[model samples]
Target: MPAESEFTVTPYSVDGNVDYEQLLNQFGADKLTADQRKRFPDPTHPLVRREVFYAERNLDPFLAAANSGDDHALVTGRGPSGPMHIGHIFPFYFARYLQRAAGTTVYIPFSDDEKYLLKDQSIESISDHTRENLRDLLAVGFDPKRTRIVVDSADADVVYPVASALGKEITQATVDATYGDPENVGLSFYPAVQATHLLLPQLVEGRQPTLVPIAVDQDPHVRVCRDVAGKERHDVEKPGALLSKFLPSLDGPGKMSSSDDTPSILLSDDRETIREKIQTHAYSGGQTSVAKHREQGGNPDVDVAYLLLYYFFEKDDQRVQRLAQEYRDGSLLTGELKQLAAATIADFLEGHQQRREQLGPLHTELQPYRLTDEERRQALQTIGYPDDSLARQDSE
Candidate 1:
């Protein structure tokens, strides 16, 4: 067993006062130094650009820990409310990239069980939704062998132990530090399940580094996981985290929701549907009049079409710079920009659907169960088996 000293935790900071301009300037100066821009180009808009900067900054510690082979873990899951949208792709993709670069183990837990409460959807609906969601996630191009994907319902035996153990470690102080209240049972319990997923990999055979790629809004959950892991209640090293910014809704800067049935595009939408939706519903930050837009140029800051391009399209930096210039100079009309975005998005979705179809079924075979009789025995031995009734039965 690896000693507790094998894991290292590093602190991170984000400059509270650093505005968009300073961020852009820093990005420009540091552009030649790092290969991140080659993989994920600098976003044209200031808001997204700043977000990208912050995401990379936050990931530095996790990246370092991963290189050191410090038994870190990455945790991410979907709400299973409906078909995943394009926005759902960011966190997993970021995780895949970092995991591949650092040779870390990645665990993607299907939070389908949590969807029962969060989405207000029926338990019966969860099975089909979870299967379809897993299919979609597999299609996103993560390595099946390297990643361990588990559905919360069918895998209850595996989940329950980790969840119960972590739950006992949650003090009122820790709960308040996370959700700002110990009364929210749902919040507290959910974090326990999530942390269980993170540390579960360490309890299994061939332990590896765990790093969770998630959005900033989900930071509270990761914080709880880190705290629980650090307490060593689960007898495994604490997992590190990498956080991304939430992908904004097509309607604007507000939440990109599947329940709202708003303008956001789903992964299942066909080419024609995608085109129609973008042309009709996609918000444009340009002027109502062409004349005024030509004189003043469109604001890329709030333009939905431009933001989509930054997220999806891969191009030379010069091309992005030119697009920003053309949009601002009124040379690129809102209609044309929307058409371009729709085309780019349609291509991306079509490719994903094809990949998903090739992934075949979403079953236990793809992501093998983490705990077996032998594996459980080994984990208990590593942690000096607990004295609880359930532990005695499992041990027997």
Candidate 2:
């Protein structure tokens, strides 16, 4: 392990003009009290929260769904637009933590081909990108066997049922209710596939509690899943949902998007790139001038450095606390804080790279696809896939 000191560093004088409190309020961090806020206080918001529901609408249904006592299966799908970044791992880590605590099973899907449609990338690139993304996900410490990984384009049989079931469940009324105006067939189809993935484990022999640790932006899909889960239970019997919040980009509250083309720190980023990005770009909620900062104190609520520390730095709680205190008192400068954050991030990516290297070729080969022919055939017939050879191949 690299010593903590080996990480990159940058220095900046604080300017008091930044409205840290307003920034936090805008991002919904205002819900926390001063002391409670201190635990996370900035960009590093906690992944887990007491109220784990899908959206602001329909709280009662989600609560009722939670009470169903059916085992929860965590589901997440990657677009495979590009390399997996630190932001990509946030929900995965949360799911891993939840699975360990609750002993629940997880289902991860590589929606590589979906990116081709959504991002306008070519379909030809999705297969290789999905494979690469899967390796990155495995390196994040997800167990291959315990977690079922599937590619959307490849597993037509497994995917078709869920898609068909979802289409049946999502009437025009439901589609209009959830997605105002349903303009695209792909929108309905994709949500159905996601809903099917959510319910698949429940149909399997060992039913488990299913939860999807995802960013809040993906809640729409989960809402669709919830709707389908209810219909499936009545029609076919299946499990429901559990959702998590999205991790913000290092730049701040917006989604950590791969297509944006702005510099994002990927798991594959080298030490120098990680350091430069953190030092140069990671948003800081600190002071503009060092003199004013010392007089007025640092704003812990919006500081990017503090946020990264809360999420990434596992040890040195006391040191982190001390940094917060100094920052709040305006004794610590934003430049020094940025340096610390860059270093911490560099260390984390380095460690991740080492673990990723250990995953090897067999791990890639072992990632779950759709069911075999016999299994796919049975499932397809059950779900009503016609005699499509590609679909048959998926069952095989």
lDDT of each: 0.63, 0.59
Task: Tell me the tens digit of each residue's lDDT in model 1 across 1-396.
Answer: 234233211111121222333432433212212443233322332323434434432344455555566655566777676778888776666666656765556677788767775555688788678777777877767665567676677667667676776788777676665555433466557767776666767776434445565554565566676667677345555555544444557776434556565667888999999999888878887889888888887876677777777654534456667777899889988888888888988998899889887775455436452444665555444444553557677989
* Candidate 2 lDDT: 0.59
> Model 2 TM-score?
0.74
Best by TM-score: 1
- Deviating ranges (above 4 Å) for candidate 1: 1-61, 65-72, 180-187, 205-209, 232-235, 364-396
What residue runs in model 2 are displaced by over 4 Å at the alpha carbon?
Answer: 1-46, 49-72, 180-184, 206-208, 232-245, 312-320, 362-396
Could you give candidate 2's per-residue lDDT for residues 67-122 as a string of tens digits? 44335456666778777887777667666664554444566777764566566567
What's each prediction's TM-score? Answer: 0.78, 0.74
